[model samples]
Target: MDDARPPRARHRPGAERWFRPPDEERRGPAGTRPPWLSTLLVTAVVLIGSGFAGRNQPQRVPLDHVGYALLCAGGVLLLFRHRFPRTVTCGTAAMTAGYLAAGYPYGPVFAITALGVFAGIVGGHRRVAWAALGGLWLSHLVLAHWLYAWLPPAHDHAAPWGQELIVTAWAVAVVAVSELVRVRREQLAKVRAERAAAARRRADEERLRIARELHDVLAHSISVINVQAGVGLALLDDDPEQARTALTTIKAASKEALGEVRHVLDTLRAPGDAPRSPAPGLDRLPELTEQAKGAGLAVDVTTEGGHTALPPGTDLAAFRIVQEALTNIVRHSGSRTARVLLRYGPRSLEIGVDDDGPATTGQGEPAGGGNGLVGMRERAAALGGTVEAGPRADGGFRVRARIPLAAPPGRATGTDTVTPDATEEES
Candidate 1:
């Protein structure tokens, strides 16, 4: 059984979706119904309204197939409004103008053309929409005023001048509303783009923060482990007791490294959860000196102006800068001795780390050649501070940082507060 139905009678798969009305086409976050309902509703309204309008105006030609076809064409053109806005606008306007020039009743046919104009303007075809609407109005003026007697149902008179004024007002209102809608849509898109960029920036900063934390923790701990491994090997047979001590240092350093690394990783797993342990600050200088001793680097710590409460951010940055400076001395400096000086003023804390060096690696440049110095600078700068590191004129390498302490009167909201130990140390 071969199907011999006309091609238009056959239903093409997904054809309904392709030609759905704009109102029925569901946009993201602006859900809509199927196109068929709007199409049938609008087409029915055009047919039924124009039918009634034809009876009221007996001087106009009675509603016929041509008039009904023109009304339906206006609605059909709207099916392509989203995809072919300019085409829909022009086509609907032409159909409306033809309906008028044919002496068919003026009714809901204009509504279809207005919908096309709205779609065109919103879809970034403002000029095309304006031109389509203007051309249609101009052709109507020509037919109704000058060509009326020759064009339509016998002996037609010129349309009222007031009707032209009403048409111009209607066109302006439509354009104004459409333009407003377009501007609002553009603003919403811009806001979404800005939010996405901000999220990317925040993610990048978090990545950098994690890298710096891992580098500082691993570099210091591994440098100790490396030094102890060498000492353990050298003293293994001779001074077996000294070798045992070296191995002990290795175990402790590895444990601390694991703890800090785990702390950093925890933030990634569950952000906003309170840390299991408090962050290290200058109060932990004695512990830092102990770790340096295991690496064979003797660190001398001194403080001026006594101790003061520091904002958590400034405290963390200061600790990291000093820790990284000490780590570099242990790994790269030929000198075994290092000096740390912390001068706490009323408004700022200045930290200095110095090593009398010829670099162990003989690279006369900065330590590690990694992002160590860069990380230090970033931390200080984030705290509204600065870091200066260079080979000193006095024949040693020096690193200096000045961090501001914009402390609050009492407990602060989100910012870190003065710890209990800091208060007791100040006393």
Candidate 2:
């Protein structure tokens, strides 16, 4: 004989979904546990306390089978308080009223009712909790009046009005505590969200800064290599000596670029390695101009107003702006001559780069659509400075930057000091 039973429901990958409450009734908030565990704990305590108190009642009224059954059912219903808080609260309240009306002994059954009310309020059901509380109050009033009429005259220990006042005060206290907890949880959640957003913003800024640094380094070096390679190819058949010289320039430029790129990459690697090379600054501008000259641009450098100290960050930004301007001149400007002017004022440093090349649509426009200018502006703005780039009326392009000398508040004035180089790169 084949035994037959309904086929067991298939347990799929997300089988737990079958047991989970609806999304709306799941929990108090995101990242919190479902309230089932807490509800079960509360039910256990109330059930045990009711049993103990029922045994200790002084003026015990006989509890019939129906009364005992109602008490047990009320305790079990508390297990679903979080999922159906209002319904559970009202059900417990009605059961308590029925037990008292049937002349069962007073016990901790009211404690279970109070737990339901608290659960309802904390589970975000304020209106329903209030309604349940009202219904409970009315039921108590009727129960109290009925007992007064039915009990022996000498056995009435307290006035029904005074007992009602005590119960009302207890309900108010539960509501107040639940409201406080809810407000605190909400505040903590808001703070976490703000912290996450701030972290993301900082991460984005750091990424942009890294991208700008990589672009400036690679673009300048690659443009020099490109020009030198073309020169080598052009002179290969006509002037072998000049062609060899161009190849040498390409080799040196590639080596320096690779070193700088390696230094930057090492910073992202694990610590405990050799100390990093010093970052390039104003002192490196002469070498920069020489490299530009090797790539076939006639470069001139001039200084006025005397040199002054600068913060490391400001020094780095200034060097990068000039480097980017010269790179643009070599790659875009048709003219072969470029001039760099450095003016040190009492409160600021002015850097200007101008190339004698006609302004054209794509000429002097940084590759990838003006990201170079955007990076330059971001760097200057971070140091409370400004940069201007445009075509001169006479037909060439000029880029000027003004950086404040005064250090920003709370900024350290230590190892980042800028000093003028005693020797310049030979033309």
Give the top-scoring candidate (lDDT). 1
User: Each candidate: RMSD to true structure?
Assistant: 11.6, 11.9
lDDT of 2 at 282: 94
Q: How do the residues 211-308 of candidate 2 rate in per-residue lDDT, one tens digit apiece? A: 66787899899999999999999999999999999999999999999998887676545223553787678999989999999999888999999787
Residue 76's lDDT in candidate 1? 77
Q: Which residue pairs show backbone clashes in model 2? A: none
Give me the displacement of residue 224 in model 2, in angstroms: 1.1
lDDT of candidate 1 over 175-248, digit per residue (tens): 88788777766665565467666666556666667777898899889989999999999999999999999999
The candidate that achieves the highest TM-score relative to the unseen native structure = 1
